[model samples]
Target: MQLDEATLRIVAILFSLLIGGLLLFSWNSNRVNRELLVLGSSFGSAAVGIVLIGIASLGQSVIYLYTGVTLLFFAYGGGWQTMRIFERRPVKPWLAGLGGIFWLALSLIDPEHGPLITALAVAVVPASYTALMGFELWRGRGEYLPSRFALCMVVGLDSVLLVMRGVFIMIAASEAHRWTETQLTMTLSLLIVLVNVAVGYLMLSLIKERLETEQRAQTLIDPLTGLGNRRALHLHAERILRRQATSGQSVCVAIIDLDHFKKINDTFGHFMGDSVLRTFAERATLKLRPVDYLFRVGGEEFLCILQAAEERDAVGVMERIRRSMKSYRIGEGTEARGVTLSAGIASSRRVGYDLEDLTRAADAALYKAKRDGRNRVCVYTGDDTRLAADVEGRAWAEPRPQAGPLSGPQLT
Candidate 1:
């Protein structure tokens, strides 16, 4: 097959971009290091692709043989590692290696016949690897969410190109009837190679997008508590407000503060103090509905946004959160110890109201809870009356059934 100089240049450039993009993504060390290994193998594949392009452009028999051999090595190695990544025992590499040896022998015997086997190997190896990749992704389908989805899409596209490439090569070598007259068999082959190069670039782009999304998620999440941080709270509130304004949906904002938190820091030391704070938020998280949003607004202060069916429903959710947090605990040095919490609830059903207004109401209720004495739950009604009352207080109301239990943050 003879590729035009212009077509060869385009294939070479696309392969170069694929290699560059893979290398760039590999430099980001935040993801599991094994993924970097995968990216490196992909880069190796791109390098082999470039070499093949160079051989095709020059029409050098020896170079083409070398390129075929190199690609087989890359395919086997990459496919093997990718299997390991998905926790599958590597299978395709052995077949691919055997196929590689077969093609090398065929190349020596007859270059014309060798293109048949080499093309078959090229097409089959990637096709098999792509199949395994799909299965691997499906097995761990939702384990990493959108990352797996991106991988599946990328690999699926590559597999289609791989199969198409094989058919193109087989037809080019053995027959010339399939392609249009203007589309030379060589040009068709080059076009298939170009498509694969494009697919590889697209894979790299997907990886980059996943990494960027993770970084963005990290910025919004509080590392210690695993809850939304102040920034996330603000952004989420803005979004909720926009939605509510358009749809007239009810939104409730609740404020929570740990009673006598400084005492925990002073008595237990700051490490245990942080643990208590984190545990409080974590426990609160379990009690929230999926539509409800929790945030670490400040030191020992949290805000929850509830998509409630009604104001009463929102209060009930906050009550559950209060009870759950009340039952959470922090370890006391070597021994586990229990802790309690206080929360102030507030909400706004009306659209176009500022988030700060709800915060003020919740804060007022929280202040009243503190003033009524420690370890109490209060609700802010939009009125002159303070929500704090002695009988309604439920903090420290539930005693731990066990004296010694693993406590504090629960390790996630």
Candidate 2:
């Protein structure tokens, strides 16, 4: 079979355009969100191939050839960042620097040898990337999930494509220094291009989906305490309330505020204060029934909604949390000591109302607890203005009244 220079040129131009478009898009995207160096590398490699084999000019190849070298360096930087994401020790960037220099030598030494070097370089880069991902997986470092798995698959596929290209190079070299049969080369190239694009799409889709899912989870969780934020808590509590209303089960709510939290912040610094709050939350959560839900409304304030057999169970839970926090250590020095939590326990029967009303009632009881004394628990039954007024008047006596996420009650 005869090789057609015209057809090969068309194929080269088409692939170059594809490569250019993707590289341009990746460059723009990297400005906004940087972790797409692999996209750029793929385009850069293909573009060099186009210049070296397609146009067949030394001047043009020099420019594109350097582009490929630069891209390899960029990918190595990306891989370093990728290593950080997995908390692994980063390899020296010079490893990639050396690889880039080697590729440059290969590209400039002889134009006739360009295609073979291009194929080998393409395989080497993706193989390195795949190796990075695989190493992380092997070490059991980071969240080794489907997204990383897909990335491995994509890089591995690129290596196979490169190897196939190398096979083409060998065939051409064996056939009396002539180009490989154009028909066979075109068909195989088309299939490889199509498969690569499809795999790229799959990897992109999986990563995007993973990112969106994580964002959603972050939205629903309290970043500091790892508890449900007010939004998530409200949604969950409302669902539980609806179920209770239908099944006629008992439910209770408790509002908890750390006593003298501001003093801890002011005295020990916000970092230490944050430590105390997080520790308190962790201890408090462990004391709750699995059916119970905890929420961090805001700084040093949390809520526990309990689906219980009766009001007594809720009171017991509140007491347990209060006691545990009183013994909980703050800071990690010779001065490390204990902190306390004040809580208000309110039941549906006591409030004789829905989850929102019960929450408000718990807040009222919390005021009474603070008014009477810090580190105590109270239950709401009647109008709480007097207790709340007294607590409000104390000023420095309370923890400066750091409000929860929701200042006033809202319907759930």
Candidate 3:
């Protein structure tokens, strides 16, 4: 059965309003998230546009019809902006507002000029928005978002359908609504409403998934140095260990502590100490392999895991980092110093020593390195059982856990 324009308008209004309510509820849950606000605005504008079109269907002014169509284009433009904001791209609201202005201008000129003469010109505005949004989603499909490819297809198909409708209207020999009142037009109208509701749900899911991913990252990341925290280290190390069990590859764990950190903080202030930590974090990561993980396990301490063919290869990396730290400077000018660090290397040939055990062994070796003098690498050779026992007996022997990123530089 073919539905009339009035029926299509009513269905569109209800669907748009439902989607708008969903987005509004999402926004209400997290008012601080700007992306939710944008999504809500998009659906809300679409709902208003559908309402206006429905009113004009029941014998309102033609201005209501034109404005409704323009607002519909504006609503789609908001979808484009919503995607951009979700991807951390800049949004230009004026550019979107211009789409409505373009339609309004064409509508105003239609009375003075011939309506048919400007009909094609008026059709181009919405077509342009739909095409641009489709292209953007298509072009950026696999860049970052997990749901990008699906979005690309949805928007792309919508753009093609809208353009097809415009083509039929522009070339039609009959008067207004001649092509619009056809079976194809009704089908497209109902489909557009249904697809828009689906798109709204998909977009909301994308935003929520992206937000959850970000929240997880923040939970496991060091804000200052942008490295993994102790929690991240433990989580990833277990995964690495499981992989190592299958491959029989040696995994090396290193505990790194800055030398004379208290002196650095005392002489140069905590800011300079933080600069040293960031510098070390950058240098250490650059010097390590891509598969390796570097984490700021404590204020002035870092933990690294090397998945290598042999334990000696890991030792080589730790030594390289040690030598690199010897000449590294924290500040550029008068506040600069050749900051140094000490690291303790431990290995796990099998599953006997887990992340905690490896860390404890490395800590023991690290304490010895600090005692023997700073600015050197110490490898655990299974000969530190006495010190390991001492460390085991003292509950507070290990460094402080990373307390939600490094707030202040450690004294020692």
Candidate 4:
């Protein structure tokens, strides 16, 4: 119940060191996360600054006080820089050093300033940095993180407290020299210790949540093509269908198979085959609208979901992608060859909103495209009637094979 200023400062120092060591240990496990490194350094610097401030208090030396305050400024700067790193923004080392530089300049210009001025100046540094950290987190609130809002609130509250403390120092300027021994200082130190613990825990939670999200995303992404995998399709299809149901817009499902993909793999090796797949993915992505989704469901096979597009629109988009692939050269120096893709499209108007039904219809039309000729687009019409588009962009009707229990390469 009777916590002295020295005892509170010691507790603060111990907490900083503990949090800093934990963050550094975590960073050691994953060295690529520079945010952890910067954050840990911030806490480490804070601990050193507190120790120096304790020494200054014992000796009653302005040099140690100023130096410690400067270190604390850099520590706050490090906190700001940690936010920038978390948001994937470019690091500005000069900006991070600005607070320290400003404090040092103030010390040089007004070496004989009263303790009130010094306390106010020190408060300004952490207040500005914490406010900036809150702003950075606010800007990144669009990202779904459970701990982000809590971190923002904590930082914002700390900033307000620091500003209020500065105001209190100004109001009680006569007692400024004995500020550290006051009850307010003791309370502030305890608050800093609590804030440090909360922020450290929240930051660790934020990092863990982010890593887990990315890991889940990786599982649903094709490593080679960088497109969504089948699992992604399964997850995302329902959302697309719900939107389509509400808007009453047609959704077109297209099953695309890389024509002669096996031959290319056999002739040029798997590396070149991979290059071709990546190239196709790039070209197809360029031709489709941002609202559309493309997934690599199987080997040399892809699925495209066109939002708010009818059958003809889907066919035209697929045709553009087909032509683009036709122009791309796989290899050079006499071994060069062009690639082509065949896509079968099925509209939600006819096939309904079910993903499985649309996939089956698209697969049927895709089979028709492959059976008729490669490098073409086919749209499934109810019954045995199918509309096929040739390389010349001419559409013709062809009889569909008898409907069996949804055959050939299930989209599951």
Using all chains and alpha carbons, the TM-scores for the candidates as numbered come to: 0.67, 0.55, 0.74, 0.91
Clashing pairs in 3: none
- Residue-level error in angstroms, candidate 4, position 236: 1.4
Candidate 4: give its CA RMSD in angstroms. 6.4
Error of 2 at 223 (Å): 5.1
Instruction: Give the per-residue Cα lDDT of candidate 1 at 350.
Output: 32
TM-score, ranked from best to worst: 4, 3, 1, 2
Worst 10 residues of 1 by lDDT: 403-412
Question: Which pairs clash (backbone N, Cα, C closer than 3 Å) in model 4?
Answer: none
Instruction: Give the alpha carbon lDDT tens digit for every residue of 210-231 in model 1.
Output: 5676788888878888877888
Q: What would the per-residue lDDT of candidate 2 be over residues 357-401, giving only the tens digit for each residue?
A: 887888888888888877777767565423222232222211122
- On lDDT, the leading prediction is 4
TM-score of 3: 0.74
Residue pairs with colliding backbones in model 1 are none
- Per-residue lDDT over 220-290 for candidate 3, one digit per residue giving the tens place of the 0 to 100 score: 88888888888787667787777876787788888999888999999888998888888787777666765
Local distance difference test, each candidate: 0.61, 0.61, 0.71, 0.82
- How far out, in Å, is residue 260 in model 1? 0.6
